[model samples]
Each structure stands twice: as structure tokens, then as C-alpha cells.
Target: MKKAAIFDMDGTLVANSPVHIRAFEIFCARYGVTDWREKLANGFGMGNDDIMRLVMPEEVIREKGLAALADEKEAIYREIYAPDIRPVEGLKELLERLRAAGIPCAVGSSGCKANVDFVLDSCAIRPYFDAAISGDMVSRCKPDPEIYLTAAAALGVSPADCVIFEDARAGFEAARRAGAGRIVALTTTLPREELEREPQADRIIDSFADIDDIGALLA
Candidate 1:
């Protein structure tokens, strides 16, 4: 199997889950949805479309449409997060090492194309990835293997050869379903205990810096 790396953008690429939650709060306030927290009780790893449908009332969705709400909320998130955009610890070095080793990489994010571009461009890491699969491009997002599968296909790599990186339970499940060779989840969004409660990730780390040997993980 050819070796490759696949990454999830939101919490995995940058510790931006807090920023997303804040953006959702702002959007919910604007829409008079005070119960946003409860609405998102399921999980935070889902795509914007799934999030809006889960958090917004039926009437709100009917009035503004799911696409419009997703766009607006993401715009707000970008405005709030762009000023402090940076890659997670050890990201640059990891990418460089992977490149030097000739292992192709791809971004498989459950975020919209705009958000994906925003993060990649803002962090100046767009050139590191050979391919990217965004939420808007897929009919189904995380918890389904479409995004990861598509990214692997774009890179001409087999899922069994890809080391999928993620930060959420849903993302882990998605990676597993995609048949990634290994699933390395970061505890950036959730604690180790919580992540370890389930067997989604083959290994869980606090950050990219925690990995002393990336090659070993893939093997």
C-alpha cells in the first residue's frame, strides 16, 4: 500500500473548535435560538449543513433556508477567527517531514469550501496538501466515508494506505468507515478519557508534537 496522510481541518488542523462554538453562539443569538447548546447536544464534529438543521428550528430553516444560514454563520466564524489563525503545534514540521519523505497528503474537512480555504490560506499551509475535500463538495459529510474516500481518490492513494488524522468522535468513525490504515485522533477538542472511552482512534494524542515517529504510526 502507498503511504499517505489525510487531515481533518476544524479541530485537527487548528484548535479552532472554541471559535466555531462561539460563532454558533453568535449566530444562534442573532436568530433568537437561545437553546443552541442543547440543540447541538449531539456532537460538534458534524458539517455545517447538519449543524444548522440540528440547531435551527423548522420554521427558521423554512424562512432562511439551510444554505443561507450555513453561509452566514461561517462568514461570522471566519471574521472572528481570521485575526488569530495559525496552525496547531508541530503542524509545519510534520508537513515538511512528510514532504521530505515523499508521502502525499490531503485535507478531508467537514467544513465548507470557504472555511477550508480560509484556514488553509490564512495559515499559509495550502501548498502542503495535494488535494482537499470540503463539506460543500460532498452530499454526506462526516460519520460517512465520502469526504475521506474522495480525498484518497484525489491523491490516487488507497484508504488502507492513508493515516487519517482527526479530533472528534464522528471524524474517527468516518475515518474508520473509510478503512484508513490508522486513525490518530488529537485530544485538542476532547479529553483523552473521553476519546479513549470509545475505540475509534488507533491512538490519541494531545498535539502533533506528541508524535515522535509518524512513520511508525502509519505502519
Candidate 2:
């Protein structure tokens, strides 16, 4: 009964929404776009390409190119967020414990490979994960269940045997649609009150420390 633990990178593993929002604001300012913050908020939990399509003009995308624009914005985000890169409270200990228990873990993120690598490497948690599935690896992003499903498959585990740890509404919904065994909502991005309202969340925790028994959760 191969069980796996899957995690979302940005808000779930690292607290970087503020930095991401700031980067978007900088990118929009440089590109003469307005209301960037609102666009970022509206497009939260989505891939950079998807978010850019909502905020950037067709001419701008054509001029800078979608890939280039995404790269630039993510570069800005990485620069601003690099110094503050650290795991969520108890994340390292939790990962170690999970590994010790022989629970294979994977990261399934809407972030690009660059951003995901930066976070994992900078936080020193990359070695804990057996596999990583980024936005670039999936044709469909969260709320579509493709990323989560891909992670489960990459870990050689069934969707029904995987537990997804997520911080956003879209991620929770994705886990549910993926038929994950359990959807654990992390309050790193959203308030507990808000996360509790998500029907897909089988368990809501503030941090990994709150979970005393990883084996129990997997069981």
C-alpha cells in the first residue's frame, strides 16, 4: 500500500506570497501595467503563465514573449525572496521524521522549475523529496489535479494512497479531485478559519509541528 506525501512549494512550504506580490508590482511598474496587485491576488495559486495572461496585455506578451516575461518576473521574485528563504515552522523536522518513517515525499508546485529549485535548494530540503513536479512538468495546473496526479505517479504511489499538503483553496480542491487519500490544509497562506471551510481538507494544521504522528496520517 505505497503511501506518499505531496507538498506545494510556495505558500505551503515557504512563506513567499508577499514577496511574489511585490515582484508582480515591480514587473507591472516596469511594463507600464496597472492594478497588478489585484491581478496577483485574483490569480493566486495559479502558474506564472496563467497569471501573466490575466494581467499582461497581448501586445506586451507578444513583445517580451510569454516565457521571457515569466522568467523576468520570477527572477525578481527570487531576488527579493532569496534572503528570506526558510522552511515553514517545523518543516525540516517534519521532513526528517517522514523520511525516517520511510514515507516517500514529493513536491508538486505551480511554480516554475527555477523558483521551485530555488526554494528547495535555499531551504535545504531538496534532499528529503524523492520527486518534484513543477508547473513546467504539467500541462494543467492546480484545480485540475494534473500536478498532484503527476506527483503521485512519479512517486510510484496511487492517487488514493497519497496525502497532499496544501495552503490554498485551489490546491485543496486539486487534491480532492485527484482522489488523494487525505488533504491536509496548511495555514501558512490562509487563516485557519478560512481553511476550515474547505470541504476537501480532511485535516487543517497550522504547521507540521501540529501533526504529532506522520505514520498515523498516512495510515
Name the best candidate (by lDDT).
1
Model 1 has an lDDT value of 0.89
Residue-level lDDT of model 2, residues 60-157, one tens digit each, is 99998889999999999999888778888989999998899889999999999998899889999999999999999999987789999999989998
Which stretches of model 2 miss by more than 4 angstroms?
none
Q: Model 2 Cα displacement at 12 (Å)?
A: 1.0
Find the 10 residues in a row with the least total lDDT in model 2.
Answer: 35-44
**How do the predictions measure up, each by TM-score?**
0.97, 0.95
List where candidate 1 sits over 4 angstroms from the true fold. none
Global CA lDDT computed for model 2:
0.87
Count backbone clashes in candidate 1. 0
lDDT string, candidate 1, 1-219, tens digits: 449999999888999988988988999999889888877756677888898888999999999999999999999999999889899998988998889888999999989999889989999999999998998899999989999999999999899999999998789889999999889889888888998886878888888888888668667
Model 2, residue 143: what's the lDDT?
72
* Residue 208 lDDT, candidate 2, scale 0-100: 82
Clashing residue pairs for model 1: none
